[model samples]
Target: MVNITINGKIVQAEEGEMLLSVIRRLKIDVPALCHHEAVEPLGACRLCMVEITKEDWNGWSKFVTSCLYPVEPDLIVLTHSDQVNEIRRTIMDLYLARHPNSPEIQKLAEEYGVLKTSYEVQVDGDNCILCGICTRICDAMGFHAISLVGRGHGKTVAPPLDEPPPDCTGCLSCALNCPTNFIEFSDQGNKRTIWKKDFEMLACVKCGATTITREFAEFLSRNRDIPFEYFETCDACHRKETSLSMGRIAAWTKEAQS
Candidate 1:
């Protein structure tokens, strides 16, 4: 057992615990995006960076992502700091721009004293946040159906070949595990959304949200090999995608040229 000061309060934690995990275990509630309890620490999101001081280490820790940092004996940890807040705010802004209307992001922003950003992505009450929490959590379930695809600004959750991951086993673990309803699923931990086809599903085009039959998505990918992770069509715009695909087919006869 090692004793350390956190936020100026002395606290005792295990010798080799990750700083982030130790903080959460102590009920510190640090903000997290890429950190998960089940998977190897990826540290991609860089959300849980912390400020620390200790006998072994002094000065700021810079932006060391807490999700991957090992705790040091006698270390003083500050989970929240003005610098941390600024970086976190910027991260939230980027997420908002991409997803725009994710309730989870919105809630996080509100908690950090950031009510709005200079740019707000269009909010249609049905936007997928694309935060990656669901995908990360899916690792815990051993079902890798949904995942982050592409790179940088163009990244998104996808299956395989942009098609649904075949080994999905129809588990909607992603949706049930998602902090935001960006992905589709029926029951939590049910391996059905990753499999099946020909489902009666309803989607919201603006937000790309699914209102019914998330399992149907698996049908398209697992059965047809089409990347059907995103919304096919909302109940209101079901014909739009089809019409666009089919184009304008008018049957006005050949006029009266005859």
Candidate 2:
């Protein structure tokens, strides 16, 4: 366990635990995006920056991303100091400049009192804040289906070549992990398309229910050596079938006694 002072209150945190996790544990108010507990911290949003003063420092404090920074002994942290609030407002302004119409961005702007931005708004019908959460989660899933492309003014997240790559398995992890809801999805009949890549849907043989994407099923079967018979039944039908089989065995045992 490590002891650190957060907003002048001493708190105990597990060794090597992230500062953001500790801050959240302390119930300290801190705004953050591009942070998911299940996925590794990217620290791309910079909205969770906190001012920290080292024990040996000569009254000098430095700002660091709370999501990636770990707790240590004798560390003095400020969650919402003047410096921290200033930095957060500036970062939110930059995000608003790029995504003016986003409710999430606008909400944060309202909270931080950021009414306007000096930077020129880039109007390209894009609402992505470029937090990279979608791309990071996709890479973590081992699909590497989507990623942030280009640089500077041209930087944007998209599939490779701005078209769906064959590597995408239609996992929908990217769309699910997207904080800004930038990823689009379309489902029509047996086909489901996301990012311009269409995937066939697998249906349960018994219930005729759409089970999952054919690409996802194939990927799982190929990687885990799962049998085709397992995919033939959907989750609900499989549970029902298992219950019925168990009941039949119990009935046979009762009949044998008679």
- Which runs in model 1 stand beyond 4 Å of their true positions? 55-61, 120-132, 137-140, 186-258
Estimate the TM-score for candidate 1: 0.64
lDDT string for model 1 (1-258, tens) is: 888777888878777778888788878888886666766777766678887665645464666777787877777777788887888888877767666667787898888876777675655434555557767766655566667788865677777676646556544556666666556554422223332322344446465555545554665566668776444556556566667655533323334343
Q: Which 10 successive residues of model 2 have the least lDDT summed?
A: 121-130
Candidate 1, overall lDDT?
A: 0.66
TM-score of each: 0.64, 0.89
lDDT of 2 by residue, 1-258 (tens): 978999889889898989999998878779887998878888989999999997799999999999999888889999999989999999988888888888878888889999887789877747787888888888877888878899997888888888778899887888877777778898777788988988988988888788679889988888889996788679999999999999999999999999
Q: Model 2: residues >4 Å from true position, as ranges? A: 252-258
After TM-score superposition, the amount by which residue 60's alpha carbon in candidate 1 deviates from its true location, in angstroms, is 4.7
Clashes (N, CA, C under 3 Å) per candidate:
11, 0
